[model samples]
Target: MGMTAPARWLVAVGSLLALTACAGTGGSPGGGTQRQIAVSTAVPDEPVTLTLAYTDDPPSKALIEGFTKRHPNVTIKPQMTPFNDYVKSIKLAMSSAQPPDVAQYNPGAMSSLVPAGLVLDLGPWAKAYGWNDRFPPATLETLSSDKTAKRFGTGALYAAPGGLSVLGVFYNKSLVKKVPKTLGDFETAMQQAKDAGHAPLSVGALQVGGFQIWNALLNVLGDVKQYRSWVYGEPNATIETDGARKAAETLTGWVRKGYVPAAANATADTDAQAEFAGGKSAFLITGNWAAAALEKQMGDDVGFFLMPGPTAEPPKVASGSSVSYAISSKTQHPNVAAAFLDYLSSPEAAKVQFEAGFMPVDTKTDMGGAGLPVEIKAAFTPVAQANGIVPFADYASPGMIDKLTPGVQGLISGKMATAGFLSSLQQSWNEHHGS
Candidate 1:
């Protein structure tokens, strides 16, 4: 199909800006960067095959199927990698002579790709598809960053979200009799569960799951802008604050009360989830990405809610991230690669995303399902509508994860003080952002 006059105008404008950005950056490794390519809204009728290197499976594979079904001539070949290996190896793959047409965006990997100019700046395509209006503004912001990629939330657009996710609490209905109205009430429930010989919470302090619990608490307790500015790498930003300290104290208190597992530091996230699903724990603090598996295991016994605040009524804030994708600058077919991204905001794609246990990029799409998803959607709507979602704390710096995971483990093990935990994270942020 030919482009309409308005679409043609958008293409022209997008092409001009993209060309300027690419030229300033120059060639990538292996001399594979396309610095002079033109932007277009059309894909040719001839058969085309594109390779996508990704770690996340369900939504990645399923979304590809949904896009290719619409354009039968296009074939997407996926190169799956384990998440741990993908983050360490993707930079080399993207810098190769024959790079995948697209790859799932990883902050660690993209930190190198952005500076090397190995990933296409998707600003032009974002404009052509009116992505600003179609997707959540904050979701898009996390995918963008400065040319150096040292900071996020501004500069060239690099990716589009395939699926959205939020961090919250999941409870076993048989263990908790009612939803807690406040943070105090929530603690009371945990105490009751402990008295009944049930572990109040299952924590996976051995990995990111440990820090995620602190993050969910920080979302409700900390000032959203302060945390966001710190995560986005704004100059002079600091994570050492009263709110952050309070959040840290709360986590340590959970440890003292015997609410967190003694073996938390040795538990992997999947193991923690399995323990909860098997009805060994009353609650598990995790992302919506775990909903599908937990639903299958526990059936009608699983429930979800954002972590309650100190007061009965509090600002709806939560930490979240997207399974977003970026196109390689070496790809011969940028337009075709971008078409798949455009489809991410469509109604059909929304259904596929939700069914695969992810929140859709189009937050407005009605998730016409029941059980755990319905509960998640109900808890998620107000936060997204209020624009209260913030990026994960690990996004604060490339090395922030290194500090967070272990710092949280120390807290669970009764070795680290709250002040020390906050300072360790701030130390990593300082190293990256400059004090």
Candidate 2:
């Protein structure tokens, strides 16, 4: 019997990707012999055409533009979507007969796609391109399955990273000069801001923004090794733990003291960004992704601090995750898609994305000359150099967003107790993910 329509569609995408792999065998992606192998595999006459979808953000644009110039024959038609509706758009697009050749996807969404056999395996091309050694182990960790980090899960490396996306502290320059390193210092500073008649800390818990607060607290109070379970595990054991309550209590203090803005809980993302940019608040807890946005508004007037380290504990650390590139299972030109992936991680392409307002994940490529926002490179660079972990929020399913984000809004709104908040999270995780 012939395959079902969806199954045939899957086969078609896989075959297209494999068809490209079959044509050329030598050059790899990471440089040296890999570059030589890629060059020797030349199907230069073949045109690579792909459709990609992602949030219509600056870094994404810069990456796409750079990809085009490096391989003129390979063209990428980007299907940009608004941040609020991007997931929906991607879901719709992926279900179509002509899905994008590559698409940016979160871990859970990707996992779902993996089971459907919608995403192609990149192992063959990863080997052919030598991304095996070209990319960092951490990045490969995200691209790979939880089962193993050595290879792209499902045998194909469907995704590659654009940069290291980290979230932490963003603060106003005109409002505060010194950044606090420890939790105690942070408390003192928050008091100082309050005493000075300013909102000591600005938190925007609107809709899905609450995830950051939970993660930021964990960043300061939780144990590093066990944090992953807080995000991925099903038992919901984390909410009942000490770190969870401590983290909640710290945030509650900020709310009760009127250190957080009156409208903070109601405010969406732009509220915090605008407040920091305009100097309304002393500090904004956010991510490196906000670096470029702040640069345009605050320039040298902005700075960052890692989420507070333990008062008697180690230094405060920011959270980070690997940026990656993904190929469309529906793409007609797999080799061309691979070529762009190669260019993306290349020194030249890395500079383009870096200059477009982000820190490049490619260690070999120096972005110093790219002239990125000075405040970003100056502030977060040190914390990143100090090394931190990627918190649970970005790694888990969108369903997790439904759990923690609202809990955050409830916490800020005085609807939930610290213990209640943590207990809720524990219960929700177990109900969904399972113990």
Candidate 3:
């Protein structure tokens, strides 16, 4: 089965916590008296070999091919790991005496490496490559953290996104007659679908899919800065707010109305997608990463849209993330690795990233095509330009996913109240980042 958004976080955070001991004891990778690597803006003519450890296949493998084709003298050896084993294995692998030159960056899984000084700071390289202008500021912000990795959006840069992902709504045109123009219109459409003897929405309450609905609601209704601050672990950040409560209540209201399937609590994300593709449901809320399989299954019968706000205009914000990578501190070829990272922002790489079923980090590059990809680009470009793409709520802390999965399940099953659900999420946030 295709990997779901929830499964990605499970593998990322679960593996990171399990191997805490492998993290380095040093300060932030950028700070301290660490020896500086001699690097240049130009790729070396001499023969060089570098290794990369990563989990995401399409962009990773395809990007490597693009980089090597440009610099034939440089050979890159990639070490691929399953998503489940990647966090734990990469931690040990990066901390080893002979580490890969580059590794994919997971804020949850590889965060420990920041303080341990196992990963390169990349600040110098960022300046050299002018990455500040090349990549999106928000994308780079998520990859950066403080010495303890507790706070983000400050300090030296760690990684660059090879590809991006956005969360939005996918509707079956065969079931829903037309697209919704406002949140009210959206709800009305859901009711209309339910009234017609079709499931209004296919939700995977068993995993991240359940909360993803809440996430979309919150994005349309809530303040983007407040949510971003909380996810970045700002001081005194809290998730227990009016907008959050409303989001919870709204989700529960859907359950009460039978718009969301009662069996959703038992259904996994892949199953939910399957149901939507099978035309059992009118809509599915998920990231663009699922676009390929969904397009293949539903074809022109499906269409995509951002979750609209109260008015006719869609919300400026959406929840999304990137498939990003970082350089290892112990690598002998920092420049070569930095060059590979730089290539991520190029027009060539943008095409490869898009063809491989991901949004390119170079948002300005044209991803011209047809169907869902075009629809996604149309919705995604404006948001990216406005810096409206924010990380998912579960990314606030390591244990937050543990709270979200069960809390959303409770909402779907009618076993938990709105206040209880919001309180549970706040408890997890408070535990990791104090009130």
Count clashes in each candidate, considering only residues at least 3 apart in sequence or on different chains. Answer: 0, 21, 1
Q: Which of candidates 2 and 3 reaches a greater lDDT?
A: 3
Q: Alpha-carbon error at 115 in model 2, in Å?
A: 0.8
Position 19, candidate 3: lDDT: 17
lDDT of 3 by residue, 1-435 (tens): 133323422332222232112112223344566765655555667999999889846489898898898778889988999988888998888878898889988777656788788888787777655677778788988888887787889877888889999999999989888899998899999999988999999999898999899999999878778888899999987777878888888888888888888789899999999999999999999989889999999889988999988899866789999999988887877767877887887777888999998988778777666888989988998998788889998888888889999988988888888888888887888888767
**What tens digits encode model 2's per-residue C-alpha lDDT throughout 1-435?**
134323432332223343334332221212113211122123255666778777767466677777676556666787877777866677667767788877775565565565445555556666555565555544554575532211132234557777766566777667777877777787788788888878776667785455686677777787754565555442343656777677888788778878777787788887777876787778887777777777777767778666767675544355666555566555556566665665555666557766765566555444553222444455445555444544455354435566677788888888988877776766666655555
Model 3 misplaced regions, further than 4 Å: 1-32, 56-58
Q: How high is the lDDT of residue 269 in model 1?
A: 97
Residue pairs with colliding backbones in model 3 are 24-116
**Is 1 or 2 the stronger prediction by lDDT?**
1
TM-score of each: 0.91, 0.80, 0.92
lDDT of 1 by residue, 1-435 (tens): 144423533443223233222222223654354486556556667899999999946499999998888778899999999987998778989888899999999999988898888888888777666677777788888999998787888998999999989999999999998988789989999999999999999988898889998998898888889999999999999889878988888998998889998899999999999999999999999999899899999999999988999899854888888899999987888888987888887777888999988887767678775899888978887787677879999998899889999999988887898888889998999998888
Best by lDDT: 1
The TM-score of candidate 1 is 0.91
lDDT of each: 0.85, 0.61, 0.82
